[model samples]
Target: MYIDPSKKPYPFCPGCSHSMVLDAIGRALEKIKADPRRTVLVSDIGCVGLSDKYFNVHTFHGLHGRSFTYSCGIKLANPDLLVFNLVGDGGCGIGGNHLINAARRNIGIKVLCFNNLNFGMTGGQHSVTTPFGGKTATTPSGSPEKPFDLAGLVSAAGGSFVARVKALDKEALDETIAKAFQHEGFAFVDIWEICTAYYMPANDYKKQQMDELIASYGFKTGILREEKGREYSRVLNSAVRFQTSDVRRQTSTTLTATKFSHTLQKDSIGIIVAGSAGMKVIFAAHTFGKAALSCGLHVSQKDDYPVTVQSGHSVSDIKISREKINYLGIDKPDAVLIISQDGLKEVTDILPKLDNGAVVVYDKNLQIPKTEAKLIPIDLHGLDKTVHATAMLAKYLTLNKFMPIEALRSAITAISKDKIRELNLKAFEFGTND
Candidate 1:
């Protein structure tokens, strides 16, 4: 009854062993008393993924072999939440690296993989663990390679808990699932399900002979491994919050402030600042947007950064408009700030689309090509590009009398720390005087 059968009817093949796995998960959730709102179920594209709707939990079905990747983010965003990944053999077969790495990272998550010995989502086909010498749609002559060892891989990869449960053993599977759910670090459960619609009938496999079938292959059941390890989130929190005791907040009564809200005008602008990631370009954009919010103006800011977080060029796109800004993206940005050669390259990529009067702010150190857009160049001298660029941009806005100096200052003060606030205020003064 926990499952909303009216809105999300159970959709599984007749006699499919996947239902047992679903029941185990439901029982585990019930036993743990997990909050429906705080529990996220990320599943892959297969019969297992179909179970996503069966539960009232917030669920997302992702790419064929990357449900765990999505779950990683879900857990990271809300570390207090209980996250589970439901994937199939196809996901594990192709996502072995992801699985191993997630284990090694000891992410605080539970992973349930329905291992039906073949790709059960599709017709009976050779999957990541297709029997080495068994027949399937893709391997009519039988699999020549060795079937993957999912359990051993997770155990060796550093999962805090690992288990292989037979689908038919409902009590054992549910208990193991509950344990996995309670684990502090990464927990993996490999449930061997029979594909009644495909894999079962492919070899004339009968439901009555399942015990014999399991015995022949030495199929595993119950908790295979369990250990205690520092969870990824716990370790990360310790590192992030270390020596940060001064961040406690004051009483809401003392923090409260009166507000006069006003809408933005049609001439509202979009500004982009681009440079290397470590240069604080994203933070600068965030500061500016937050400042604009303090001014009773509408604003939105977005950042683009590569995987490395340090070496690659970064971009912060900000929009400020008077009226309800219909669109956040600014294809024809009103202004741009380029801090390095890498930033200039990104600017050039969209140079042709810039409007006739759009402005370009660049580092004087770079050999920027001439353009019809108004050019404002600054010398970095190895100084922070955020401070210098924000100063210059704020000065331009104040001089044009389009934006208020007090509003900008109030914003800067509202969001910045002591040293940073003092430095930025001085920078604003310098730009205003310049």
Candidate 2:
């Protein structure tokens, strides 16, 4: 029997799912009587790196999004010992092509994908798992794209065993982990955890939201069973040949709107510059895009990666012109919404190059450059003093008379009706009026 390390407790932030996954894996090991010295736990960058320091078992921390490749190598060399991988949604989803190819090869390793809906380790940025309309530091407006369902992806990618279980569901989760270990081939388990600080709402709002999600979706653990045979061996061999090409094709599909010229001409479009507020802008843009499409408007988007996390110049540009727009125009914003101090500093560049046509909206505290465009300054900081929710702040901006208030409200309601109504009604009212 292997001794549990006294320092086994990993240094993950409160509300993270890594601890539960580690415990479940450890319990699974105990159930199977696996020796710690022989077991190798491999993880990629981010919170999984902490596993190297915390777990008493032999551990390996690989490059960002390369945990599975390393696990493949380790298991291929030492086929007798057990190999496990602990990875986050960002690590898995970002490197999804490689992971799925690894699965198809029937690599003898167990994978615990900590699918906390978004990237927790990177300060709650929007990830491939971040559901549509979910808020994060990168997407203050809300995430625009829908999250990737790991179970379905892995299952279709030829994983011998695949499951999706909630982190809060201890019994079901524990059972899923045990079963994954028992499966004689590659196994994948996705653990859904909450990011309370970065991605989720505040304390009171989160509790209510959690209750609602539990009541609605409940907890689920999916399992796919595949017997080992000649067919399986044939499949594995063929997978290795297509792995590289398949991955390249999948990577080609990721959202790639880089230049301003590509983003601006939509009947109603929302552009999100990548970084701290990228999540928010994407959510808002997607919402507006849907509303516009429903109203028979062609929506296009422009997006670019930000230079850094805080204190850098960033912009989320949306073009809502009725006319057709094929070229990107940063200076022609219809009505701008500024969330961060960085946004305010870079407002001049965001203005549409048009003369006396665009509207500039920002917090009164920001120093709007003296320009030819009409400026609408709202006291958001003062409004925030009364309403603490970021969702509320977003809604307040959505209700401005200059923009499509009703459509934006409809988008917010469609995504998070209860939270929008309960948390931001008062703030929205005050900001709209004040």
Candidate 3:
């Protein structure tokens, strides 16, 4: 449906499926002839927020985990306007608490979630919808835990109308979008879009794979009607059913999958770190750690942590051989530097849960853990260490042989020489490297 010249190119990364999903939304809008003046789009973080710049309709990038809440407010204030939620799986799934509460209240809003299966904005990290064994920047070793089924979860949460569509199926996507918009109460359409940037063999390879899949598989489109005796009927009815009680089951915390997983990783350590700052951590790995594999070492970051949006806690790390640990001990960290009491707590809790011991380094004087390991203190109290943190850490690694001098120097020089010298001596003089 996206004609060659009609397709507008933006700053989207190569192979991103967001443009396709956006096209489908536009087509559905055209088919329905929905009044753009009477429509307000509420979106959360990530590329979806870019809708404000792309579309002529009113759009708002709501706070994390609060898209539906904002949409609910918009609809309640001006019942004439059609409220559409353009969000990612993380925005609606990981940010699902607000979404469900809104649905239970029968907020007259429609949610169009582009389920790209992983985070797209801050590099490709895993989301709640990331399929098991899928590869991502965060899940290089593949995802360990399974993905949550979003359609079933919406149905269970009493969504009025819920349907699943794919980016590859334009007709189905168009139909699904129309049905979701036509619904009376809270409606959800899960757009299973592909992250061409993250989850595919190159574009050519993926095109072939897509061709094969399309050749073998058949797709059908229809509206999911709530049955008479079904508990999910409060939404599509003539009136809003604000009868939501303590129906908060264990399922509320669970992330559900709406389609088969499309992950492809076959390694150990199916670890799923957070995103946001975690993106930097993963970038550091790709920039530094991938070379470690040449030395016959292995590493992988997976997707199996908290959050369900395009942006949140940034996370990334790698699994390495304990046999050649230069800095961090193979069994436990030789020393764990505490940026705050929270870091101290995170390490201490894990020490009790792991087979090793860690020397806790604290900035602020705090009660040390009562364990056999030593507790070293460092006074980084008033150091302006943010800009030079990586270089300083690199210098420490160089001094301790945690990394090769050449590699550490390369990473530091990537910053600046003055920076390297200043922070290196600062860290060494303060004995923060201990």
Candidate 4:
């Protein structure tokens, strides 16, 4: 069988009902003769995410609450694949709108939610699915809001099949999951997972207490709704026209020149400058980006700061690449410039990804700790930290012969105002001299 029965000793809390849920899912996969190569299981964040390591089939651990969205793309790309998404109540609750819309569109996918009534990973805080009067870590005084019928909501939103299952009822739960897999369109199954660790005693919810609480709130079990709905993949397959084997590939001979041609750099570099407000981090990124653009290099930059606007946090992510850059977000930068202690703290996590060989330039006066990246510290030189550090970085780049000196000079002259133009020119020369 493709599903591994011995995959656990599960990581769930002691007495957690997730084992039963996993059993039913495995049995369902067996009933359908699920092939490991054609199957992809997506796991949402929280306890359910642990299943990614347990599954024998191809799988991808998804962003918090976004497994279903990722599934849509995967299914759209290859309709023959069987994709299963496992989510916790918090995953669907925080991103409830995505759940309803996925059903409404009847995207070809099967989604199972382990509704334990709270965010399990974050200490059992009250989630959208938490029942009224159920107390959680956040809801110390019993919850006041009523929980929604997750199955009914999906059905009404246009899911082709919707069911509710109890973890304890293995035979029936397995049968229900099998039928959901057989459905041709969107399928949603809500499985009850008991939170044995915190929820049980926090709300005085023992086995019998759970029965009464659920009954009082009126949640149903078994198939709640089953009907035909439009399958997004089926419709898309019929609508799309493309050659199955004869694919057209782009070639330089067939390509046209873009206006950004001259700005294209032979090689690329990424830099992130961060610090508090009034440090001119943005100015530094702009100066460098403009210089790269002048050389016909593709440049992308992003800035982030706090609401205080005067002195909190600031970050600028810049990428200068020869190829047409696609994703804009910077993960591991080639270089990082620190202007203040606040900036260093802001990107502490990112600094670890930097290679031991990566360049790290900072203001020496900050007196921050050392790092693995090649450290280049500069004196403030009675000039703005932003300008000084930028000049230092430029000097390093120039020494390494990264870009043309003529290009950098032209950019500095064009960007700087009449008053500061001479000062910036002098600074550029100072950087090379050092």
What ranking of all candidate models by lDDT puts the best one first? 4, 1, 2, 3
Candidate 4 Cα lDDT to native: 0.77
Candidate 2 lDDT at 238 equals 68
lDDT of 1 by residue, 180-278 (tens): 999988999988778887777776665555566556668666788888878887677676666443332331221212133433455588888878766
Best by TM-score: 1
Off by over 4 Å in 4: 242-434
Q: Model 3: what TM-score?
A: 0.48
lDDT of 4 by residue, 1-434 (tens): 65565776778888787767886788888898888899888889998788776778899887888888889889888888888789998898866888889899898799999888888887989988888878899898988987887887888888888998877778878998888888878899988778887677787666676667667767777888788867888678756634422222221111121212242334567788878787667776777676666555677889989888787877888888877788788767878878778888888887767788677777777755556787778665766554664575566566445556666666677653775666666767767666
Residue 235, candidate 4: Cα error in Å is: 1.2
* Model 3 global lDDT (CA atoms, 0 to 1): 0.57
Winner on lDDT between 1 and 3 is: 1
TM values, all candidates: 0.67, 0.50, 0.48, 0.57
**Ranking of models by TM-score:** 1, 4, 2, 3
Please report how far candidate 3 places residue 117 from its true position, in Å: 0.6
The backbone clash count of each candidate, in order, is 2, 17, 22, 6
Report how far residue 315 has shifted in candidate 2, in Å.
Answer: 54
TM-score for predicted model 1 compared with the true structure = 0.67
Model 4 residue-pair collision total? 6
| Residue lDDT tens for model 2, 35-116 | 7878888987777667766666788988878888888888766666688888888899767877998778777688888776
Query: Which RMSD does model 3 reach against the true structure?
Result: 23.3
Per-model CA lDDT versus the true structure: 0.76, 0.62, 0.57, 0.77
